[model samples]
Target: TPPDPGDRIPTGFADLDTLTSGGLRPGRMVVVGARPGVGKTLVGTGLARAAAIKGGLPTLFKTLEMGDEE
Candidate 1:
């Protein structure tokens, strides 16, 4: 079953959570867009790590640009 839409999943960053009104909402899609070398991957991995480790939420990560070793 899907999580409640009103539920927020923290990203392990206080400032980010504040900006996003306590973190990301469940059952919503988020897109991170930026120029190259602007920490897009860093932010994405951080969020995934936070969700999986801190929030204890099931997460899925898929990347077309990176290989298994990366």
Candidate 2:
């Protein structure tokens, strides 16, 4: 089953959560766009970490730019 969209999942960053209006809502789309070397992957993995580790929620993160060998 999927998580309830009504509840929010914290991003593990207080500032981010605050900016996002109490974290991110489930079953919603979010896009983080920026230039290279600007910590885009850092932010993405952080959210995945928070959801999987802290929030105990199911998450899947795929990167088109990197491979397992990279």
Across 1-70, the per-residue lDDT of candidate 2 in tens digits comes to 8877667888989998999887899888667778878887888889899989877888877666677985
Q: What tens digits encode model 1's per-residue C-alpha lDDT throughout 4-67?
A: 7777889878899999888898877767778877877888888888889988888876665677
> In model 1, which runs have C-alpha deviations exceeding 4 angstroms?
67-69
* TM-scores, each model vs. reference: 0.78, 0.79
lDDT of 2: 0.82
Per-prediction backbone clash count: 0, 0
lDDT, each prediction: 0.82, 0.82
The C-alpha RMSD in Å for every predicted model, in order, reads: 1.9, 2.0
